[model samples]
Target chain A: MTQSHLAPEVMARARDIVALYPHPRSALIPLCHLAQEQDGWLRPEAMAEIAELVGITPAEVLGTASFYDMLHTEEVGTYVVTLCTNIACMLRGAYELLHHAEESLGIRTGSTTADGVFTLEDAECLADCGRAPCLQVNHRFFGDVSPEGFDKIVDDLRAGRLADEVPHHGTLVRTERDGGLRVEAETITAERRATAAAMAERAATAAAASEAKANG
Target chain B: MTVTDAPKIVTSRLGYDDSHTLERYLATGGYEGLRKALSMTPEDVAKEVDAVSLLGRGGAGFPAGRKWSMLRKAPTSYLVVNGDESEPATFKDHLLIERDPHQLVEGVVIACYALQVTTAFIYIRGEFALGLERVTAAVNDAYGHGAIGRDIFGSGFSIDIVVHPGAGAYICGEETALLESLEGKRGFPRIKPPYFPAAIGLYGEPTVVNNVETLSNLPWVLSNGSAAFTALGEGRSTGTRLFALAGHVKNPGVYEVEMVKTTFRDLIYAPVLGGGIPGGRELKAFIPGGASAPWFGPDQVELPLGQDEVGAAGSMLGSGSVVVMDDSTCVVRAAWRITRFFWRESCGQCTPCREGSGWLEKILRRIEDGEGRESDLELLMDISDNLAPGVSWPPQQTTICVLGSSIPSSIASAIRMFRDEFLLHIKDGSCPQGPAPHG
Candidate 1:
């Protein structure tokens, strides 16, 4: 690897996530988020470390990371403010909220502020539809937000009033657990081998079935 | 006549302020369902769920009992609870995950007992910060309660539930797509043919993927016999369904009312419910279900909120999200916004969804921006027809998953119900109502 981006402790936590699943690859997305949480975006170094941790290629990691809106490959602000302008939110003054936020932030959607503290995006449905016109700051949701409400939250955020709750952009969940589901390392390795064999067998079965269909 | 609203089954634990806490959950007979399910054999428990006819709440309305039964015959290895509720105006699962996480945990536990699965994962939307926290805590609390993990409740059914966070993809809300995301891949849905989760699923083993709301219902179903659950809502809809009412409603919120028996009118107009539209506005149209469902005009307000009844009405109550739009609302603008949502969230794997969604959104944008040609109307429909061929109700899909099929609903519903609005936009070179819908 070019460099070790994750610290010893951070690497342990990443390993903890890997242990939670029967297959280590299942930890890939979570680790991607964790890497972003550490660096605000997925760095090549972090992605390389993750690939090493999960036994996947860096290119493979990028393929997965690029697919999600939240996992960014490039730079992002410390706080990502995504205003929902989808159906429910749009009908509930989301555009107005967006207009106001744009004016207040002095930056358009999809651009970060001069301070690099905030990045604004006009997002899709954030699942806070009952309280329409929702926006998420660093994945923390704020629903039923008016222009004034959005402005107020921004001020609070800038003033560091809401810093404790509104963390840096990728820290969605911070709940520490006693432990995760852990099976022995050898058991997981064996299971992976078995799963690979099963997959190959299924592929053979499908090939034979297709061949039979063609012959018939 | 609409039947009187039934007692809440799934949302029974919702009203209490501390309802999310494990203490509150235990005090309010939280793990009773897990206890009750443990008392019965796995087969018996599965039978009880089957007797209730509990359809999946995460759209598709597949019977939960049937899903488990299918997995029961196979060597099912995992139970993944879908908590990824990202549909516009759909927050029932979010509410369940955030407000009564312990109840959800209890439900997941009961599901494990019935399915006899060892490891279950709760894949919650990553956007839900509080929900992730609560569910994470709730899962841990369940383990402490002996509801999950090692020899749960001394019933000899040990299970582990991991709450996995989704990084932000609406397509991941789809079942197989969810599996792909859980497996740490892109949220592209697996092409269907040998396409049954009961056959091949997570890690190439049989897996039962159920919704959070569907699993949350199990605690209630286990405690109050399946007969009691079945006796509530009519036909296929056999319980109080959580309807998240949004848009122009005065009191927009998630209300649990008897399915099929309750009308959209009651949910949106009743004083105890939506309390009618805000600003004394006259209702123009409403999306009967989620944003994907073809909308219902005011004339269809009396349509029952049931799987069959709504399905018969050309739009399935797909995600239990009812969005009302009033007379002052610009249908063109609203349709554009909905189109934009689909376009932005198309996952970019399928050509029709990837290219078609962007094409549809651009057309809507130009129309809304007053740069419309009358031909644009036909173009929208043509493209919609291309993606969802025939543009018929119970849409035909050309893409891997339903997201491509879903793009046509808003466009078709607007044109079918409000052609004049589109014509007005074209004739006036702008939306006659207003360019800005609510802002």
Candidate 2:
């Protein structure tokens, strides 16, 4: 990845991003974003070119690129599964889910399966502690999984049963105050219809009270 | 408690039963410092800060007063209070901001006056939305009482204070990096030399950055005078520092102590302070300054709990956030957890920090899981060495920030001090130090 090889448009955008900061070298991370956007993954050659563009050494570029899990320094599969295994996720059997993922995919952490379908990596806290045992396939999160359930999810991905319409986990079933389940709608359902009716009743009651006060 | 007996300054403003409301704060001599500062010239105030030699409590330990004096001689210099206390195990700044909002506001006004700046921003942590409201209310109350804004105490100095919440990036705690975040950009730290905040900061004018506690000390210093403020601590590192104590201690909370007066044993073993190790377990290792500072084993426990003393012991008095670990706590687990934090928060700016921290985290994880080779320890050392006290090309003298340097310091020290414990995990393929289940 020589400076000469960068697409002229990508190089221009990288330069512009670097120029935003007072010091150009401070733009290293953002430039990597530009490079990744251009090349899909951070190639060593592209990183070297970015280093030259940002007035830093290639080693520095490589270091910054590899530091974050989000940045893909190598080729990745079409779908990326990032599992959150920080303290909260760990307490909720995230490790079981991770192991299940490896077994299903026939690939270890940091590797893409031979089928070129999925890439898996252990992620840090994603700020979704409320929904423990969560994993994000690309941009969507699949939360609250048992070991067998996680295995089924990977199988569904492998089978193409779940279409890639922006990968998402199932609806989050929140625990209500009285220890009952309150399922918020991730998909349109009869339960969602009941919730809507209850909300409408409350709104009508408030409106009627306001109307009565105006008449008085 | 008598002033001499009670470690004065940082915790002086903290009361267990104190309400954070403006009325409660005012009833307790909160605005006295602001009044005293308003009565004097800004230059005189700056000079007084220079006299006390107070340092920033946000890890760097840069002299607070000296920082104020460095602001460009412009009509509109800015004072930014760094309340982004993002270091793991550091919670003292949040306590002051939440429990004593007016005290922080008073400190801000005094600092703004000293720097000859009418506009100030409290760069708060994004997660501290509750804290933001408390500070905002305090600022409004001060305005209503003429303690801030135009014609404060009949003085011509008018100060406007605003709370700017950050997007919760740990790197923003660094002074230069903080300035970048405040400008509504990604919180990436800029290299120094070509760009120092004092000269070209926050819209390319002069800006003064002070820690929340450092600014909070301003009002007291202005009221008591420099000599009195300096009298409280040792030479050079004058004034009181807030130490946030946590982990395995019976009574873990923030304590205010003079810089040179406190000892490690007194702080940790004193029943009212940290209450020694929990459940009578012997102390194994301790982190003196949040997660970034180097770890100290039991043999190093006798070292005094002061800035100079701690630094001489090959660690820092960073933010004064002390975390203690007992015998049951696995050193390997602790190192792995702290390394993971750095890896997650690396910002991916510098190569050594980004790649090095992730590698270290992965290696530590491997060691904790009993899959580590003997050479893995050597590899960890090599990676950490590259991250700290080493020059990088483009010739940046140190790691990208103190964060990069400090993360490795804790890991390397933990490995050096407790190799047997780490080796046990590798040999047994399980954590022998894992805590027993509660009844």
lDDT of 2 by residue, B200-316 (tens): 777677888888888778767766778788777676677777777766677666777666666777778876677787677898888887677778878876776567778777778
Query: For model 1, what is the C-alpha lDDT against the true structure?
Result: 0.86
Prediction-by-prediction clash tally: 0, 4
For residues B1-439, what per-residue lDDT tens digits would candidate 1 score against the true structure? 4447578887877779999998988888888888888888988998999999999999889999888878735554888989999888898998999999988888887887788888889999888889988988887777777777788788778888898989889999998999999999999899896466877889888889999888888888889898888899898889888989988988888988998888989888998889899887899999987878998898998998899999988998988999999998888888888888888788888899999999998888888878888799889999999899999988999999999999999889899899987888878887765564332
Model 1, residue B230: displacement in angstroms? Answer: 1.1
Tens digit of lDDT per residue, candidate 1, span A108-205?
88899988999998887888887788888988888889888888999899899999889997776888655344467899999999999999999999
Task: Show where candidate 2 strays beyond 4 Å.
Answer: A1-216, B1-4, B16-18, B389-398, B433-439
Report residue A8 deviation for candidate 1 (angstroms): 1.3
Q: Please provide TM-scores, in order, for all candidate models, with all chains considered together.
A: 0.93, 0.67
Indicate the residue-level lDDT of B241 in model 1.
87
TM-score of 1: 0.93
What are the clashing pairs of model 2?
Answer: A1-A45, A63-B351, A64-B351, A67-B354
Best by TM-score: 1
